[model samples]
Target: MRLSKLFKNAPTTNVTGLCFDSRKVQPGNVYFCLPGMTHDGHEFIKQAVEKGAICIVHSKELKPEEMPVGAIYIRVADTVDAMNQAARIFYSKPSDKMLMYGITGTNGKSTIANVIRNIRNKKEPTGYIGTIAIEYGNVRLQPDLTTPDALFLQEKLSEMVRHGMKACALEVSSHGLAQRRVDGINFDVAIFTNLTYDHLDYHGTMKSYFEAKSLLFSERVKPTGKSILNIDDACFEKLQRISQAPVITYGIEHECDYRAINVQILPKQSKFDLVYQGKTYPVVTNLVATYNVYNLLAAIAALHETDMDLDVILEACKNLPQVDGRLEQIDMGQPFHVIVDFAHTPDGMKKMFQFGRQIAQTHKLISVFGSAGKRDVAKRKVFGELADQYCDYIILTEDDPRDEDPAVIADQIEEGIESSNHVFIEDRYEAIRQAIESANPGDCVLLLGKGDEPYIYRENGRAPYKGDNVIAKECISKYCRHINEAVDDVNEDESFIEE
Candidate 1:
């Protein structure tokens, strides 16, 4: 495809490749000047031109004097939108060729996307783009952002097409929506998991946050897409009214297009009756937590809208396993249970605790958690308060302190703990060890906050670190032998007492 054809209304220009990074610019490439939070792409215009960029597309107004002598400079109201459009044309609109289902909301987006991608057989060659990673066929790319830039997104979609993928499940973040990163992709189905107070630092208010998410279902973006929503969410009623696409509702509380009835949240698993189109499907999922039932229902509704056979969907659900870092369980033959969860938000933390309480019968629930620094300070106390109410014991530790003092963040969480059952520990590894040492045969320890994150963000820089799953496994193995020895010692003491 010619570069001239890619620019809908802009002047015709010859280009060889497309790029946003100045360092990657080459002769005949069109350099998209993007404006980011920290740096403006316009600042690198000279570098792009010097590197032999054929044309420039920028969000800001450009004066004739600012343009390179021979280089073409096109100014648009939004460079991000323009880049998305150009990418669509360059990639021949790959999203339209494959069935694309986009999952958006504050939470469950990644989990739902992963579950859907996992259940789909390899025969169709499904691709996934989300917080975890991007998978095209058998190839995988580690994800640096929840959603990549428009140009990169289009490139990935095109690659998926080349690999003969029949479907793609993408986790669309509000940041991606607000920035117009996924502006031109045509989604066959759009999913709304649930909207809660999150990313307020960027969005400013809950209303703004919802609006950013609403952009995904707007007529301009996804006019022909089917909207699968959680009707039980308070924001759904208003969103349903405004959404331009056909709506499909899924939930547990109220009647929806897809509903789960007689849902039982067990410690190790959950069982529910899935009702869709008046037909019932029994589901026994190893993906624990009542919250996951809603996620599973959302995925089912999306798959159903794709016209997949109900039996196929059910089979997929039954075989679907837990997503990594999302409520993953680690067992080392210890009498007690251990779980690692990516519950960063207050709502997520509360839900995990609720599930923990339900499954922790005849056992104590011990929780170890921390808050992310330089983000969402308001939720620190909320996490503490919930941890206090739910867990038998709570340890407030370090998450990603970023540039802030880890101790200060721990104190912020400590403020919400009204119960005397909680302890504050700034060292995360020590906290995990302490929790393990304190646990008895019937106690369950939960490591929360970090999830699958593989690094610790500190003031200096990000340091390589093992994920919660790894740490949990090590802690369990180290403590299980000690637990057995202690048990033997206790038995001998009891025998002497009896004698």
Candidate 2:
């Protein structure tokens, strides 16, 4: 493609590709000089030029002599915005070619995106891009961000279109939206799960965090498209007010367009009657928890807005696969139960514990968890408090203590605990082993944080740390003995709330 065709301003240069990292620059590729938190891309202009970059798009000013004499240089006010626009045009505006839905919130973005993909994939070819993995037909790759950069995103969407994917579900994070990663992609449906205290290290305030999430419904979703929101969320009113698309509300607490009534959260399943447009449909899913119910409803509402059949949605919801690292069970022919989850935030931990307690019933509830270092220190105390309230025995350990002392992180968490039932273990593997070893028959061991992540990040580097799921199974097989007895189910009288 020619640079003149992609940009409004003319530059008679042949563009072979687009790139931001100079290390990946190739001949005839247009290198975008995007500024970062630490290093400036402008500093790498010489390297990019030396690597045969034919065109350069930059936000920072450079002297005439600094640039390669024959290379094309286009100055823009914001290089990120220019990159997004160029990427969209270069990819032939692929987001407009398919039905695209975006999900945003503090939690449940991955879960909801997975649920929607499962539902849509039953009828037509579908793609999902989120925290866990990116999937469309035979294309599967680990995503670096919940929402990838504009260039990578446009290229992937174009690939999906070529592969005959009918729709795509994207997990839009606050940082992604704030950084203008999804600037030019048009969403056919936008779903807001909920907002809570999280990512304060970057956003700094609850209002700013909410504003970042609000950009999806306000700017990305087409005006004629639909907005599916959880009416029970405190930020629902603000999101609804700012949303340009028509609203479709879903919730279990308050009345809404699609509501889950007569809900039953069991030990391994959730049964609910979905009420929409004066009709009720029974929904039985492998996902257990009130929050999972909300995720299911959000998926159904988003799909229904796209003119999909309600019966098809319900059938697909009933048979949906378990999401990776989301309250996933690890059963190695043992009498007791073990669960692995990615509940890093306070709200996420609280929800995990609520569901744990309900399913535990008369059994002992053992929790193994730790907070991430150098991020959201205030939540450390709250996590300790919640653990104190819920778990029968708490085992505090390391959780990606990047550039911070793991012992200091544990000490901060211990500050809020009034009970002496918990113990601090620096080694995550030892903590998991001890928790699993001490559990008796029918007891539940809950492993929190670091879900399916393959490495433990610390000191500006990552070490080979096996994911919680793999470690849990390995520990169970090593220590726990197989029993002929089965783990007892939860009591019928117990109830769960998304506290």
Candidate 3:
């Protein structure tokens, strides 16, 4: 790829690759000086040139004395937009050659994206990009963002194309869309799970957040593509008005194209009567709760829009594997139940508690959670209040405190607790150990927020974590006898969710 070909009004120097990080630059690479909230990429241009960057794309003006001898400098008004263009052409518009599914919402993005990738993967090679990882075929990499920047997204899509993937499902975040991180890719099918109160700190207001999510259906979808939406959500009418593509509606509370009625949530599975086109079919899925019914419907509707056989899709849906870190269970022959979940938002926590209360029934429900620092400080106390309402006991601790003091965050959450049953423990490990150690038989321990994430972010930096589920297992091992892995007949890896 030549600089002149990749960009207008540029030199004709040949470019080998595109990069944003100066440390990762290779010879002949076009290094993009992307701006960030904390650091400016322009400050690293010297290092980029030193590491053999041929073309420098920047938004800020630089002195001629600082420019490398042979490096070509091209100034743009927005380097993010410039990077998106360079990536699209450099990656040869990879998304255009394959099917693309985009899912955006406050919650259930990961679950729905995984569902799409799983269903498509059964027919042909499929890839996924979301909260979990960037995966297709034999490759899997932990993601830095729920939806990565445009450059990484395009690069991964191109890699998927080269890996012989027939389709890809992406979890598009509000931040990603607002930052123009998904500029060039066109979505074949765009799905909106639902919008709720989250990310208000960065977005400033609910209206701003909703508008950011609406961009997917309005601008990113292909002109001929479909928009799969949740008609039951409060923002349904507003989203429908802004969506440019054709809409396929799904809901539980309202009449829609694809609706799940007569829903039943058992401990291990969810049963619902699927209503579509004036016909009804009994649907049984491994997922549970009313919220998951929405996720299942969104995934099925997206697949059905792709012209897949409804019966075949339903059959696949029935046996779908459990989503990692979501409602994840830690069952090591413990007398009581221990569940780990990634519920961080007010809506998500409410749903988790509602489900937990249902599962506990007459049994005690114990909740262990913490609020993240430097984010929507208003919600910290709300989390405590919700837990106080539904939980018999509460253990509040640290959750990605960032730069704020963990003790301060704990105090903020304690302000909402009217009950005398809650305690604040700053150390997450000790908190989990105490909660599990104190629980009696028939009690359910609900671990919230972290999910299966392997690291804990704090004021200093990110510290290595063994994940909530793994830590729960360690705590359980202290009170219970372990099943020998040497026994072939008894598999200790069994889970309540996967059962």
The local distance difference test score of each candidate is 0.82, 0.88, 0.88
- TM-score of candidate 2 to 2 decimals: 0.95
Ranking by TM-score: 2, 3, 1
Model 3 alpha-carbon drift over 4 Å, by segment:
60-68, 482-499
Cα lDDT, model 2, residue 426:
92
Q: By TM-score, how accurate is candidate 1?
A: 0.92
Location of the lowest summed lDDT over 10 successive residues in candidate 2: 490-499
Whole-model lDDT for model 3 versus the true structure? 0.88
Question: Can you write out model 3's per-residue Cα lDDT over 1-499, one digit (the tens) per residue?
Answer: 8898888888888898999989899999998988888988999888999999998988888998768776889989988888888899999999998899999999999999998889888788889999988999999998889999788889899999999998999999999999988988889999998888899999999999999999999999987999999998998998788888899999988899999888888766788899999999999988877788899899999999897889988999887877778887677876677888999999999999988887776778998999898899999989988988899989989999999988888888889889738888988988999888877666779999999888889878888988898899998998555423255433233323311
Q: Write the per-residue lDDT of candidate 2 for residues 180-279, one digit (tens) a residue.
A: 9999898999999999889989999998998899999889899999999999999899889999999999999899999999888877778988898898
* Local distance difference test, candidate 1: 0.82
Model 1 C-alpha lDDT per residue in residues 1-499, reported as the tens digit of each score:
5566976665566678888999999998999998778998998888999999988888787777678775777778877778888888888899989888888998899899987787664336789998878998789887778988788898899999999998999999999999888888878888999988788978999999999999887743366779998999998988798888989999998988999998876666678888878888898877767788889999888887777777788777765766878988776766666888888887888888876765565569999999888898999989888988888899888898899988899888889888748887888888998898898875678899888778888888788878888888887777657666334422221110000
Report lDDT (Cα) of residue 11, candidate 2: 75
Roughly what TM-score does model 3 have, to 2 decimal places? 0.93
**Candidate closer to the true structure by TM-score (higher is better), 2 or 3:** 2
The lDDT ranking, best first, is: 2, 3, 1
Clashes of each: 0, 0, 0
